[model samples]
Target: MQTGGHIAGWRHARAADNALCDAEYFQALGRTAEKGLFDGVFLADYVGYHPVKGAAVFAGLETPKLDPLVVLATIAAATRNIGLIGTASTTYSHPYDVARRFASLDHVSGGRAGWNIVTSTMENEAHNYGFEAHLAHADRYARADEFVAVARKLWDSWQAGAVVADKVSGAYTDPARISAVDHQGEHFRVAGPLTVPRTPQGHPVLVQAGASATGQQFAAANAEVIFTSHPTIFTAQAFRADMHTQLAQFSRSPESLKIMPAVTPVIGRTRSEAEDLKRELDDLIPARIAISKLEGLLGNVDLSGADPDGPLPALPAEALAGENSTRDRVLELSEREMLPIAELARRVAAGRTGHTIVGTAEDIAETLIEWENCGAADGFVISAPFLPGGLEDFVDMVVPILQERGHFRREYEGTTLRENLGLAVPPNGFDADPTSRRRPEIW
Candidate 1:
């Protein structure tokens, strides 16, 4: 159970405005997270522009960006302790290449690298990858299961002692210890050892963010860390319990996976100031943009004809089937609260379906602690509504309170990401012990 910061939302209006592509912004963000002794800083990814051609895509925070792994590499050079996690999609990436990239990052970062595995959900992403459309939800997960399996095999191809580098013996590597993966899965076929050696953490800690039933099963079998978004504590608790139950089916312990839900905090020295900041950001979002974004979240439902101040339109019966968990939450809230389209859009934009808190440092810290203590989450993937400023506030204001309460660490506990996250170094698959030779049950 630990804290991690996601800086994607930081590029929003009124906070670090127009600095999304700046390396310095990210470096400062990394340092701030490290200063707070946060476990990691995650960089989210999207390969294509919004499928809906609208202002939300043109005027939104998700503008063109640098590659996440490249961004993380820059962050790694600036920070000493914090883990750097980069999101890469399994559906669009080749396992061999993804394995090499993350493994290289782990080496360069002194083992503080994590790979956030995602099955590309946006249809635009599929188009970018030369596909007609995004794979169906279940099909995507099926591909992801094999994708991860191939990557794991490649990572394990080289044993721990594969690299001898003995100068006197005129030997660089132990050939006997290095072998080809020879993997031929339904979605991917990867051969031989990865270009890089076994990483510092055995392999970059596998992180997943899927929330579907198939997603939970894949995470239970493979993910060491699972990033999630839930609007309420009760839902988060239920999801965590479900993941643990899924873990048991894989013969894994509940402790094997860390469930970190997304939390966006708008904090100020005073509650009123926090409220003012939220209001400022909300006002900046045009109703058109908000409505467009909301439409995307609701399974691309056409909301243009609906009255902004009127109640939400009735959802299609099969809406939940193709939609994600966030959409489910949004629909549930709309139905329960009977919210107007305008109000619902604002709330969705504010937190993007995750829990959003507006308060002083003390209030924010108390809420976070309550969630952790109540089994709602193992920790949180903190989304600062705005960049350096929002992140800086949390690190400076809320972090101290959490530290003082002994709920969070004042200093990093370990060197590698796995060590810091309290995850065990996965046993090498080439090890002689039978227990150590089993592949990660990613399927």
Candidate 2:
């Protein structure tokens, strides 16, 4: 289980314009991750602004953020080997465009790019993109199913050695080596010879961050890397087991998909010091701001000025519907733990329900290894409580501990991110001529 970090600091920034640290900041972070011999850095990107009222907790920060892929592209030029994964919404973008962009990045980075597929969950995002309301969750997944299939078709459109670039006869490509993809799906219509040739990895690795039932099925079929959310070891174990079940349904090898739950760390030289740091970060969440966020997520059930130690106000039957999964997960955990509402809210605010492993290096390593061996996760998507420095501590401290345990690699295996991660190479494009292709007789 190698580590990764998301470039996120917009919410708690003391500065007025702390959307994302500048390019120099990303480059420095990339260099640091590489120095630790970590697998890669994955960025969680979102399309459009998060919903302010119905499902998101976006306060004090500007909405409709930077394009993650573009940011990773710039970082690609600055660093050598660390993986660059960016989120691209399948609901709004076309498959062909996505296929080209990722393949281009893979080439530029020498096969070190990853794509985190998301179906935008925010209703506000839909309106901003010209939809009156968000599509039903199942409908979005249905479209995503088709979208991923089409993207894969496009990615495999050109085989390796397709581009001859021969000058003698002015023949740039071997005509027989590439052909159009005739794809007619419910959600996409693509007739293609992809604009870009084959990437060094065949395709940039496919990553999925869906935890819904429908989403899990899609990940089983398509994703080589599964980015997931879990609030506890119990939940993580259940999720991993569920994923394997789904993978069996898809007739795919369950071991092939890497499951990484989000793990946020607030580290210090001592456990007591780390706890203080965590408290400091949590204390920064203003009561009004936290209330505003909670109300939004709870569908306008205002908990403002309510006693934090008191029982939660009774929600309507549908109050929890359409809430952020991470927040919901936290609520469930709090209920399970029988925590007082005040402490629950503070903990939830710190990392949004993902496991927050705050401790010394040995302690963090032990927790991670336990999770890995106990079906809690294959790995983690480690996020920091603070900025670059928070991540720096993990690389310097936690990574070496995992390495010494013979749990993580000392070096990468292959060139492509997929190869380095031990994932399989995607197959080539249409090899046989359509005219010569014939179906086998049915038994």
Candidate 3:
């Protein structure tokens, strides 16, 4: 997330002001993440921000969005060990294009590439793709289901060792090591092999971002890593358990999928100091921006004239009827706490849906460890509340504590991201190895 994941993060005095256009800024952040021995640096870009009814208030979120693939490639060139995970909406893209991009990225990054797959949810995304409207959630996932299937076929077309340069025999390639996918599915009809060779990690790691029931099913069948959000340890634990059960249904082991929850850490030298920092950041939020953010989240209900200090007004039927779990949770929070419009907006702006850890470095470390020990997360996807500084703090301060406690690595575990993450390279699809660890059900 460029400036930071927090919507108002860019306004913070300490946040990087030029990150939107500054390649060097991102490169620096990648290096910092690498220094912490993070499994990957996740870049969240919107093909279109998910918008709902009255979403025009957000102008359909036609904001300048980065192409994560382009940015990840830059980071790939700069950083050697950290994984490069880029967001691409299967809803708005073709399976062949996405498959080839990540495969090339994996090869370029020395097997440190990952694809964060999303079935985009936005009207603008639909328009950009030359459609009149967004596909329904079920339809989107259905398409994504077929999209990934075809992509794997393309990736698998070129078997491992497909290239054999026998100079004397004048054989530069092995015809036996390659095959055409010739796939025909409900959403896609892809023929033959990907232009790129099989990547160093077999195929770049597949990461899925969606927590809905249907989304979870897709992740179980297709994704090797999942990016999820839950506000509490219990919620996260419940989610992890549910996913484990789902994985079994696909003939996958508990270790096959890594569940990574988004976490934002607000650290300070002392507990009181941390609380103060959180307050300071919250205070920095401009009321209009906060309310606009809330409006966007809740189907863009018009809060223009609503009193920021007043309680949340009765939401329209459409807002309440939508299946957005995040919106529902926000509503529940307001009713449960009787929080005023502005307060809730600010709260939402600061953390969105992810859990926030506010404390000293030790406190942050302990919270993370507790969550891991309690089966709440396979790992965490830390969203630095602000860039460079927030990330640097975690790397410099919190990382040492984790390393000392033996919860985190002192150095990366291996050269390739697959090795460091402890994932096996999926066997080439052309020739299936029943015993060989493969991407979940890729065959």
Candidate 4:
């Protein structure tokens, strides 16, 4: 998360100075995560200027973000083992380029790269890519489905024994082991082998974050690591249950995918200390900026004249028509909880970026265990309110408790992220023996 997930995280006293575009800052973050044996560090991306202006212009929101792959590559040199996941949109990028980049990343990181696949629906992103408007949601996912298919074919183009450095014979490669994809699909057409060879992981882990019906369908068929969000435990359970059913229909084993919901943990030694920190961060968000974010989320409907403390006005029909997963969740929260404008805006501001928990390490740890054991989640994508300090707290405080309880790992299980996550390495589509790529059991 840039600085942190919260809108006001940069202003927090604990946040590092000059983190924007700082390579060392991220390298340090990577090392810290590895110290705690985290699965990976996820780096988010926003390609173009967003329509929202108030927050960026006033609240010091980190914008013009570095390319996630470039940043993650930098982190790769500084740490080992943790998966380096970066966002790459199927909408704006071609399958060949996307596959090549991640293949190279997987090679360099020793098989610890993940692709957080997104079908971007942002009009602003469309504008930058020479499109008058973003594609429809269905069209986007359809493209993504094909995009991934092509990428996989490209990855599998080179078989395991494709490379053999023969000195005397002077044959550096095995032609029999390499094949051209020659793919012609509805969304993409790519011919031949990827420029990069087969990666260390065979294929980079396919990650996704889509909660809509079409989103779920795509995720169920493809995503190896699914990033999701739910404000309540019950909703999380419902979503996971639905996903499991969908997975069964696909004939995929339950262990094939991991569903991770983003959770922001505001931690402290005592309850009061944690509550104070949460309020302190929330209080940093300016009223105008908070309302502006809500406006953007609600399809940029003009809320300038609306009362900041009153209930949200009925969303316009136009806004309703373009509703996305994030927008729908915010609306659902408001309708279900009857939260006022100010309160709702505040939650959106202060890292209700996902479900937020404020408490001592024990309380937060217990909550995590409860969600896991109750079938509410397979895992969590922990989003700290502010960087360095917030993550360090979780690693030092919460992680230990989970480990002590025998629910979390005391040490990483294996070298590769797939191994650590207990996921099998994906087989090459071209392989005659699919199980050849399976990761050996570590435990």
Candidate 5:
């Protein structure tokens, strides 16, 4: 069972007054996750801001803050055991740069690094990247497919035993053991081996966060860890089943992938206290802000014309075909529950529409165990609704319960991220038989 800690929770109203830019805050959070024996601490990144939401949206959030990789590098120095996974966009970055950055991180962290591959969907992100608009969903994924292929080839360019630093003979590296990738893809072209040698784990574990059909297929082919959000157990189960089927088509074992859904747990010593905390946070969020947030999750659908007290307006077909999976889940829930627009917004604000659990430590533990045992998820990415406080609460309260129940590890299982996650090291391209290579299926 793997668990990852998310630091973006400080964006909540309850945490609005906190100093989100403080490096000490994140360092402490990483330590807390390490103390709990978590598999990783994931740092989410966004290149653009939500202008529609106005200045209030930027006020409490870390949206315009430090780069994720920079922060993860700092966290790497502060903690010894926890994996540091940073988000990067294949849509915006060159594959060579991405490969080199992550490879360097892996070496610096002693193989405790992971790359959360993302095809940035925000239009503002495109503007920042010198594009008039975001790439179409399919086009973005296509580029990402080629980008990953190039990166993998670069990572595998050097043989494991290539580095032989000898003092007597004055030979630093065996030239015969390294070769140029010479990869020419539709989206990327690389001429030579990566500057750095193979990392401690051969390659940093690949993590992905896309829930669309295309996203799942990409993940099944390449990702060792998948982070997603599902509002219901049934939805999660269906997603896992679909991923399993996709994996079989690629001749990959289901065990190679770990599906971790985002779960926000509001915990307390008793259920009543937890409920009160949840209510406090819910009440703090302004209606306009909540609606704006909900709008953003729904692919920036205009909710201004929506009657606050009435049911959601008929969604356009084009909106339904967009890349946001959260929008689809929200629409499904709203229809199923016959919810008013305001009610749906409120539920989403309260985290109710996003697999949130409000309960005591034991209650949260039981829910997690149930999800894991029922195959709804391999584990969870704990999205604390508030920083230090919420993270501290889980680490001190919920983690102990999970450990006592034997549902989680009590100590660090391994040094590398892949090792702790039970993932196999990728074979060097030069050493592997061509027939044994699992080539990703391009859509």
Candidate 6:
């Protein structure tokens, strides 16, 4: 499948597990991914940790949440070919600031910025950000739609060649080159003529990671690359079909949005070795930690005494929150497969519903090609559980295999991320309007 890397678990190598990761480490990862012939590196960020029994969640396998924008900037400086994606929350941030931050990154990185838009879901995160509770899932998506609209308007403010650095005339930038978007939306009021000029790609690439009905609609209208999670091929195909339907509703097409589900690889030289590696990772997860994680995800159902070979405990109505869609979807998958309770939990722990492809490099390549060629997914957002080893193994073994086959790119085709991904460069807001848009009074 088309491959992309995510910087989630990669941040915990040196920093306190819960603290932010350093810029240098991310830069090194960017360089490594580029060398591996990967398309892009996406950074996933959460406003707050998952809560466990009324506390900010921090346990055996969780820690180190970094600000994705800062991390992306660092990586951008270190590498030129791999796309730099950063998660920006529409629920918590303003369109003006979001637009400016990404625009600056695009300029600094020579036009390789991508934004992963999300509606924040954590209650503790909401509290930390001055809210008493999380916004309802539907409501957050509604606000997010408006937020993106405003941000897009802001991004379209300045045209390329607007800045004529004419030293002879002492005019640093042509006054007649920018426009104002007096957008007054439900969630944001961004009066634009963004202070910064446009970047190589007029606006950074837009990405989304929500799977609810509202979120799917928003993505269909805006996202170029969608990061999704599905436990099985059936669900992934169903989701792909649903997203296509959404795209049709908007009179858009699937070609506009590339849907990539999260993926984890447990690779080894042999099938037995792969199985052994999976076992080792699970064994590292302590029982107390696993139980806490299971409860946090599947409601506080006490699975401590439940036999691994036994059936799953009954799910309660209270456990059916809209935000638990990712985990709940996995339960549905496990039940369909008739997997034992402990096996179900182990699979969930391994990748949090992202598919885990384990085996030799050829085995993984074959499986990924099948998934991509079928309607299962367009690509993958590759994630790993641990540090350098998790990424290093994939880059060393699986990438070359995929490259040998014709499915993956052997070399980057363009300098900018947008060009590399085969996306068109956007025209600035006022390239069509010379006189009217550039008036000083407009800003």
Q: By TM-score, who's the top model here?
A: 4
Tally clashing residue pairs in candidate 5.
Answer: 0
Worst ten in a row by lDDT for model 5: 1-10
**TM-score to true structure, per model:** 0.93, 0.89, 0.92, 0.95, 0.92, 0.89
After TM-score superposition, the amount by which residue 77's alpha carbon in candidate 4 deviates from its true location, in angstroms, is: 0.7
Report every candidate's CA lDDT: 0.82, 0.73, 0.82, 0.85, 0.81, 0.74
Q: Report the CA-based lDDT of candidate 3 relative to the real structure.
A: 0.82
Best candidate, lDDT: 4
> Could you report the Cα RMSD, in angstroms, for every candidate shown?
3.9, 4.7, 4.0, 4.6, 4.4, 3.7
**Could you give candidate 6's per-residue lDDT for residues 1-443 as a string of tens digits?**
11122213323332224323666567767887788867788888777755554343353546556778888888887887788888989888888999999999999998889999988756667888899887888889889888887787777777676688889998887656667777767777666788888788788989899876777888999899899987777778999998999899888768778899888877779999988877777675554555556665674556667777787777666566565566566678667888777667666666666788878878888888888988998888878555455677778888888888888888888888778777877665466555446344453
Which residue runs does candidate 1 get wrong by more than 4 Å? Answer: 1-14, 53-57, 316-323, 432-443
In each prediction, how many residue pairs overlap at the backbone (N, C-alpha, C within less than 3 A)?
2, 0, 0, 0, 0, 3
What's model 6's lDDT at 433?
51
Model 4, position 165, has a per-residue lDDT of 85
lDDT by residue (tens digit), candidate 2, 50-168: 44433334544233445777778878888778888988888878898888888888889999989999987666678878989878778888899888888877777777787998889
Of 1 and 4, the candidate ahead on TM-score is 4
Query: Order of candidates by TM-score, top first?
Result: 4, 1, 5, 3, 6, 2
Better of 2 and 6 by lDDT: 6
Clashing pairs in 4: none
lDDT of 3 by residue, 337-384 (tens): 789999998878888878889999999999999999999999999998
Error of 4 at 239 (Å): 0.8
TM-score of 5: 0.92
Global lDDT for candidate 1?
0.82
Which of the predicted structures, 3 or 5, would earn the higher lDDT when compared with the native? 3
Candidates by lDDT, descending order: 4, 3, 1, 5, 6, 2
